[model samples]
Target: MNLNSKIEMQNSRSSSEICYENFMIFNSQRAGFTIVELMVTLVILAITLGAVYTTFIAQQRSFVTQDQITESQTESKIAFNILTKDLRNAGFAYPVYSNPPTFSGSVVPSENNNAGRDALTLVSGSQQVATLAQPLIIGQNIISITYTGSARFNLTDMANISIDGIDFSVITTCSFIGIGTDCDDNFVLTLNRGMNKPIPAGRPLYALTASTYCIVTDVTDTDNYLDLRRIAGIATLASCSGALPADVERVAENIEDIQFAYAIDSDADGLVDDQNANGVFDPGDYLTPPLPANSKILAVRVSILATTGKDDPSIEPSTKPYYSSGITLENNITDVSNDKQRRNIWSMEVALRNPR
Candidate 1:
């Protein structure tokens, strides 16, 4: 063998070996992605999933908030409707006297002043004073109504009395005659002792004249025994005074606030008189110059505040302001905290049944 031939054979062998090694390396490289590429792909997938999850959560929260608001609004509307209906029917039979008698004989100055009006004086038929012509005395349900009279004391011919001693003042054109017959004459005035009223054994006769007084402040106390006796009028439970007629009830246990604002026709002109003089009807403000003697309440605004969860969850902006500005209850004159709470609030407005 020659030296040149041997050299060429060795070179060819080395070249072959190099080519085999390169082929193996190229195949391995093409078989899979780099670690960096794999990591990037995983990161992109995580981001996409995270965005989708976050969007779902946001939508869920929005739905919850909307549901709560709807529930609150519905409850408030129902409560207001009930209250307005009863108030419109208040003092239905009695002629709205300009000089309505107060327990102190002092005229009730403001229509919103319920101190005496709410505390009805029950004058039994036996207590009716024939000489005075007053249907109620002791032992009777003396429901003093402030209704608009006929031509004798229509809205046009009446004036609001502003005297200090007079809670309700009126200047009438003639003897005020209410709608239909006298409300006092139509209904039978009987003494109704609340469920709490003690019944004497062996005596069908309940105490007609007792110093004891039955007090009702809220709807919960409006049971059959505590219910205000409806004069000659509708027989349905809806006609009874207060909110519920012993059937429907409040749902949430955390309810903290329930407020009322009355829309009154101060001048009996069949128009709501906004005390703030804003011309827009708002129930929160007291009737300007107070409700006239013969005026009627036309509408009501109700507000309720409640908590959802058992414990307050430390929500942001925990407290909310009143729904409407320049409108508030009589007790809220200084402190507007009626609706202040740790959880939620519901508010609404309603119109009364009958109004002058």
Candidate 2:
């Protein structure tokens, strides 16, 4: 009611009105986020989710690739193991012969009246003649062998012939002759004594020749594969005698290439003789011995190239690092010059079936 009281009352009323307006503005500001802020938040969330999804996908792909690699490695190892095991047992005969079998130089006659008579003659150790005294008749399991020449013989069967000593039956038509007379010659057998007179004498009987055959269903081209045949029989020549049994078999398929290197003990140190005297494994510049009777085949390095992916996916191209100490495929047959798919190779080392 006084002058000072009147001024204070007027100021108080103005302040109250300003307070009400400020409260209303604050409520409106605090109601919700602005459009710009909402959009920025959503964008940040999308970016984070995208990064996480990308990382997850990358990891998943890596896992898949690793799994595929492991599977390929496992398959290759299995195949190699099986092949080595069988190869080591090749040319095995029960009751080892007194003298190894030898391949005779006699030509198989085409008119022998037998389906499997085209086989090269097998002689016993005592028989040194070029021809057999008795013609190797069909279904006759007994064979004599001898060694007469410097060359060793590998007898492969043209028909499934059972050995007199061995019990197992061999596959037919997949036979071969190596290091001795070439079985590729076509000849005709005659009843004349002069034509068959070259048959050797005193040669011990050997098992009938066993053919080695394999089914190559998945081959893209026949030329890419070698039709390796097995030959089992006797030898009639010099150091070779008695029932010398030889069996060569096709133990594997998909063998894109085969290379043989001899680990000869030239110095006879009871270890692989280093022909180059480099004291290190110089597979690139090493000496290879003659086959069929090399005597010491310390190790056999094999490389097989195979394709897992079919024509559809086009086989994803990739580059992988090789371990430093790992065996390089430089000398592999599959890795020869001008080979495109040699990168996909399985390598292995096999000891000879007969180390002697």
RMSD of each: 16.9, 15.3
**Candidate of highest lDDT:** 2
Identify the leading candidate in terms of TM-score: 2
For candidate 1, the 10 contiguous residues with the lowest summed lDDT are 205-214
Instruction: Give the per-residue lDDT of model 2 (tens digit) for 191-219.
Output: 11122112234433233332222223333
- The sequence of per-residue lDDT tens digits that candidate 1 reaches over residues 197-238 is 222222111111101011222355432112223221111223
lDDT of all predictions: 0.37, 0.39
Considering summed lDDT, which 10 consecutive residues are worst modelled in model 2? Answer: 109-118
Q: Count the backbone clashes (under 3 Å) in each candidate.
A: 17, 48
TM-score of 2: 0.42
Candidate 2 lDDT score at position 285: 30
Cand. 1 TM to true fold: 0.38
Measured with C-alpha atoms, the lDDT of residue 233 in candidate 1 is 12
